[model samples]
Target: MPAVSIDINMFWQIINFFILVFIFNKYFKAPLMKLMDTRKEKIAAEFSEAQKNNEDAALKNKEAQKILKDAKDEATKIVQLAEKKADERKEIIISEATVQRDKMLKSAELEIQKMKHAAKKELEVEMNQLAVTLAEKIIKENLNSDLEAALADKFIDEVGGVK
Candidate 1:
């Protein structure tokens, strides 16, 4: 090497710079780096917790969807069962109504037959009584004006006073 020129002021500045760096490192660097590491750990913990909560929310949503689908299917089944019961009830009611209508018709026919039989019996009794009375009167009366008058009066009475 050639002759080295040493500057005394530059050498003193370099020494001062090293001392300042050593003081800064001893006093401030460790706590600052420790604070930065603590902050990083806190951020990571929060992010992981948030991701866990998001997964839980997704699971709950899927469960809720399954519950809703089950409810809808149960409602459909209940409606179908109700319709079946109603149809059966309707058939039962119709059958009962038909039976009641047939009974009423049969009762009305029996009543009509009884009424006709009663009317025929009353007419037969009246005819027999009138014939017996006529024979007795013809035997008791003279075949003259009294008989003719009696016959005419009976005829007028039987005809409801219209002669």
Candidate 2:
């Protein structure tokens, strides 16, 4: 009797375990599998978005590099143009300055020549006046020794005044 009861108890435990397994399969398996599938799809979509973002980043980097190079090249061209213009302007300024200097020098030389000619003319006029005065004295006075000495002194004084 005891052995039969033990065998029956073992049989009941086995049947109970099978019933629990069936309940779990009927109630939980499909929902669990659906949740796992949803999670797996979400993960795959995120991975795909990450790969797309990475590709976009690479393309943007290349575009940025190209833009930077173009900017540098444009800056170089601008600097070169500015330098060329500056050099041309410098040459123009120097040329104008040189012309101005030459004109001033020529004007100075002409002024000096005018001054020298005026001085020479003044000296000639003074000499002519001295000659006229001496001739008049000779004609008015007698040819005595005292008169001659006085005339000579007057001529010397007039000539010194001319100098």
TM-score for each predicted model, relative to the true structure: 0.66, 0.72
Most accurate candidate by TM-score: 2
C-alpha positional error of residue 47 in candidate 1 after TM-score superposition, expressed in Å: 1.1
Clash pairs, candidate 1, are: none
Worst 10 residues of 2 by lDDT: 135-144
Root-mean-square deviation of candidate 1: 7.2
Cα lDDT tens digits, model 2, 1-163, are 5655667888999999999999999999999999999999999999999999999999999999999999999999999999999999999999999999999999999999999999999988887777767765774464557777677768656765664
Residue 31's lDDT within candidate 1 is: 96
Which stretches of model 2 miss by more than 4 angstroms? 1-13, 138-163
